[model samples]
Target chain A: MPAHSFRLLSLGIGIVKLLRSSDWLIVPGVLLLAFFFVAPTVEIALSSIFDEGLTGKHFERFATKGAYVEVFRRTLVRSVWIGILCVLIGYPIAYFIVHRSLRTQVFLMLLILVPLWTSILIRTYAWMVVLGREGIVNNALIWLGLIDKPLRMMFTTGAVYVAMIQILLPIAVIACYSAMTEIDRTLPRAAKVLGASPWKAFRHVFLPLSLEGALTSFVIVFMLSMGFFITPALVGGRKDAMLANVIAHNVEQLNWGFASALALLLLVATIIVIVVVRLLANRFVGVRSVGMAP
Target chain B: MSRKMGNPGSILLTAYTVAAIVFLFFPILIVIPMSFSGERFLGFPPKTLGLRWYMNYFSDANWIELTLRSLRVGLGSSILASVLGTLTALALARSQIPFKKAITALFAAPVVVPTVIIALGVFIFAVRSRINDSELTLIAAHATIALPFVVMIVGAAARQVDPTYEKAARVLGAGPVKAFYYTTFRALMPAVISAAIFSFFVSFDELIIALFVMSENHTLPIRIWSDLRFELDPTIAAISTLLIVFTTAAMIVADRLRRRSARKPDA
Candidate 1:
């Protein structure tokens, strides 16, 4: 054989030897993700910018259009609000569960997980039943002579918040509960023994330790709320459309470039928020550790 | 420390927890009885209860077909995810591969990224490649999301497994593959099974990707979505009830398997 063919044959043998190695187990997964996940992400980013050979028009339209900007603003603001609500409600539940006996804790966690594992669609459907005009709440109010007409509870911002909060509350509780469990149970008792009142012991010791987990839960809920498509689309009114809803609509319209732009925006915003939160958390944790040092 | 049972603060906290639990479960509680409503409409208290809607669901061909489609997609994606994820886990836990952290992060990227964004990317890829409306494309898309769960669960299990057992097998004249298959693989079976179950549900319960990619055929969630959009009937309530039951059963099984695996002795 010629030298070129011999070199090619040697390279083929080397490649086969590499694949036969145990370390090459990652090859199949990496290939799958590279094709499906990384390639498509790159495709989306490229498509967003390279419509008819590298134009900024798609993003420009998003920035210039008042309605689109409003949708983006609403998505961010609503997600933050939902995140706050989840933390407010979920923190107490987490605290309660953590304070319970082991058996009780297990039972409570099972309750939380059952709903967490249920489909978002089913949960949203249940909300529709409860909040609809002829639904449970309105029926109860009318039966009690509280109102002559059925209240239009469905397809409103309040409905959206209620449904979203209920859907995400379990996640917040789980995050906080897991964090709280990691705390040394004797710390608060030690604080009390150090002459701090019960509230002060909780406030000064227990609260700070669990705060990181609560923040994590908030961030998770916020990120999820930003990309919420089904719950908002199903229960939310016209004015309550999120960015994900708009992207879905644009995709259906066969406006791939515009949809990709919106998706890129959502992805970037989520990443920025997560990175900022991580930095803040690291600093807070660093400060706490330093303060606790003897 | 336990709170004093007679304290006003303790009583208030108890009440608050009770109320929160009620709020969390209220929607789920409402769905079951509404599923049994004898009337055409969905009302609370579900007057004149019967299995009218459940019967409707059982007899409907479209619902049945979509359900079967969901099962096939779920099974296909879960098996793919489990196999790939197990191999990836073994590589990360046992091998001296470079950039281990980055590779693990890459495997987990799907979970962090929003489903809608991934759905759009995959949707565009499918349409551009002329692969939309195919089961394989949908299965691949579902597997992408399910990959994270399998990797996380099985990776944790693989890490806990002592390397000595496999190394001992290697020293006893077994081939590397046989060493792993006999020692580590047997120990990892329960975890892999649980992870696969979780992966199956991840795909089964998924909707946004299915909705975006599927045009001619529909998965169960897609069917539920359209029915929700175009109509409001007791049939959806029935379907929701059934899904809740299925999810609960699967969760129980997964939890039991996970616990068993956690309790297993080292090989």
Candidate 2:
């Protein structure tokens, strides 16, 4: 054999030897993800821009269309609000949970975890049951003689916000709780011992320590809220459709190119949000702890 | 700690937390009771209490079939994700793999990437490949989402097992495979099982992917979604209650397994 052929043969043999190594254990997973996850994602990105020969019409439509722009705006606005609300509600609960006895802590944590593990669809449905015309709140109002007729709470933006927040709150709590756990519980007490009031200690010492976790939870919730489908579709009015609902509608209508374009927009927006949040957090919050797991 | 009981601030905090907990569980609390309603329409303080909706769920062939379909998909995807995830975890934890962080992120990307994006991508991919609306395709899609959880859970467990045990097994005449299987794999079984259960639920509870992919065969969530869209009936409440119970039981089992494994001494 010639030198070049011998080199090629050696390379092929080297490949075989590498495959037989323990490192090959990851090959099946990488291949599976590549085929199903990476390939489809690339296909979407490609099809978005390359429908029958590199057309920009799909993206152009999204840019020019007021309705699509409105949906995108609403999705971002709602996601931001939901993220803020989750952190607001979740931070207190996490603080409360972290300060409890070990047994009480376990019990409190289970309360959060149970809801976390439950299906989002079911949780959203539960909101439907509670927020419907003849649902619990309306019924209770009438029974209390506060209203003569049922309130139309379902199929409204408020319903969407409430359901979304409820669904995403457990995640926020878990994130906050984990982060709070990392902070020395006695830090606040140490501040108190140094003559600061309890509120002051929490505001100055504990708050800063756990802020990163709160920010992380906010980002997670915001990203998830951006992709919400079942809740908004079930609870929101016709005007309240999010980007995901619109994408789903388009996909159902067999407008693959448009749907992929919208998906690309969502993907880009999510990445930007994550990256921006990390940069801001690092800059303002003074870099996350090195030991923190992503 | 001593001041907690009497302090006004602590009392206020306790009140707020209790209210928050109630808010967290509000839907679950309402749905369980409404599931027992005998009325055809959804109403709170259900006038006539009975098992009519529960009976409706059991007797409906469509619901039963969809439930079974969901189970099949869940089982298929969980098994696939668990096997692949376990191997990947072992490789990451035990081997000197290059680009470990990037590889881990690749596996974990499914969890962070919006499901809507994944659904669209999978839908387009399936249509292009002419594998749309198939159980196998659905399983693969579901497995992609479940892959992250399995990797995180099992990978964490794998890292905790002392490498010395496996090395000791190899030194004692066991082959590499046997060494791992006997020493490390056995120790990792609980984590694997729990991860599998969690992945099963991930598929079980998934809807967006199924909605995009399946038209002929509806999964349980798809059926529920349609019912929710068109009607507000107690049957959905019944189904929701059942799902809650099932999920709670599974969570308890998974938690127990995790705790038991956590308590085991490293060899």
Candidate 3:
């Protein structure tokens, strides 16, 4: 009995060793992230509170500031708007692609992806041309004898939305398209065959199935929008400032404590929103796999 | 199916889609022609057509210097990222390791987190650690950002190849390392190459983080950013056209590789 127990202990040790050896292959990547990624992130979060010792002064200052709170609220609301706009602009396009012939689908997909791979800075710059005072749109409008003065198109809220939507629409389209493709075509056909009109079949069967993907796109776009700094800074007026622009402004000023505090709060808020929305969505719609592409 | 193809609904959908595609691609490609404008500021119909902006970009010493620096940084960081990311992906393939889900999520977190937040955090770390503005610092910082892309692309590609090839190599008396090198690594080469190209652009195209961390090591994007804001030069349009071609070519290769792998049915 004693000999058998000793043999079992050695066997357990051998199994553990085998598993860990394979797992050990992941160490280099893990360590790289831990040191560079995790450490810096933890540093930022802890620095929010650390401030040369234990202190809640940064959070305290934030709690009292209405301006900071206003910025946060504006960020959230603007992001939600951007997300909804992307869905509206992208849905029909995505639905159209899914119904096309295979060759046309691939060709159209490449068209979307070309801009995706290109730099956002370039895209943003391109918008500056199209929407500038003396640019193409103004040129066309003037040629048509619509107005004498070029529209104050640049550096406006509408400019921000237009550029933001253009940048994000492809993402929403791809997300919705992938999910829409996975939906069994037979389900909608069955509804039509069972005395339902085409519109009714689509409304009841297809809409519910595709709603999950559109919602997923909305959530993703909103999450990305909340952190947008460049587009808002370049194209938006001072009032269109997002939370990320605030962080960049603070960092430039070398206000580490406040910037850290703002970053930590934004990170926590984003994670919480994602978790809560996902949970609520799962409960109402049932779990469905959604793919996000940008 | 035949009847459905000729319906009014389908026609309208096709029309709308074609229109949307035009909207999406128009602004992107217009820059190509705009790059040839002889005007100083952005204008659609030029008084003259020439390669003046392209000449300006080529002639300027600062532009040449900045381009070289960007190319160097992109190559350095991509080599680092692809090697490390591919290794990690190889290990992660067929992984039943404890906490694998948590580990994968951690690897993927960089993409989800906002660039501003990461840049801020990393800037704070650099300042505290007394790391100065240098190529090494930029490479490390950019590698961190690009690592997730490499891991996702290569890792997904690696999983498609069968493990039995490695076993077959072993049965034929090859050593473990040699077996993996010959079989799994060979299978993963296309993905690894694409991942490296993707990583290069990831470093090259980065702006916000480079804005924060870089000092004298001004990347092409940083140079373009300052120029766009301060000068409003059409030289940027020429540079942008060049960049678009490079990036589009890289993306085309990646897409072809992905489609080929998927359609191959076996590796």
The candidate that achieves the highest TM-score relative to the unseen native structure = 2
Global lDDT of model 2 = 0.89
* Candidate 2 lDDT by residue in tens digits, B89-131: 8889876666888998899899888999999899888988999
Q: Which candidate do you rate higher for lDDT, 1 or 3?
A: 1
Indicate whether candidate 1 or candidate 2 has the larger TM-score: 2
Cα error, residue A71 of model 1, in Å, equals: 0.5
For residue B12, model 2's alpha carbon misses the true position, in angstroms, by 1.5
Judged by TM-score relative to the true structure, which candidate is superior, 1 or 3? 1
Provide the DockQ value for model 2.
0.72
Q: What CAPRI class is candidate 2?
A: medium
Report the C-alpha displacement of residue A10, candidate 1, in angstroms: 17
Query: What's model 2's TM-score?
Result: 0.94
Ranking by DockQ: 2, 1, 3
Q: Which stretches of model 3 miss by more than 4 angstroms?
A: A1-21, A286-294, B1-3, B262-264
How do these models rank on TM-score, best leading?
Answer: 2, 1, 3
Q: Give the Cα error of residue B40 in candidate 1, in Å.
A: 1.3
Task: Please provide, for model 3 over A1-294, each residue's C-alpha lDDT reduced to its tens digit, 9 standing for 90 to 100.
Answer: 999999999889877885656556677788778866888899888989987799899888878999888888888888889999889888888888877777878888888788788888888888888888888889989999998899998889899998888888889889989889898988888988898987898887887889989889888898888888778877778888888888888887988889899988888888887888778888767533332111
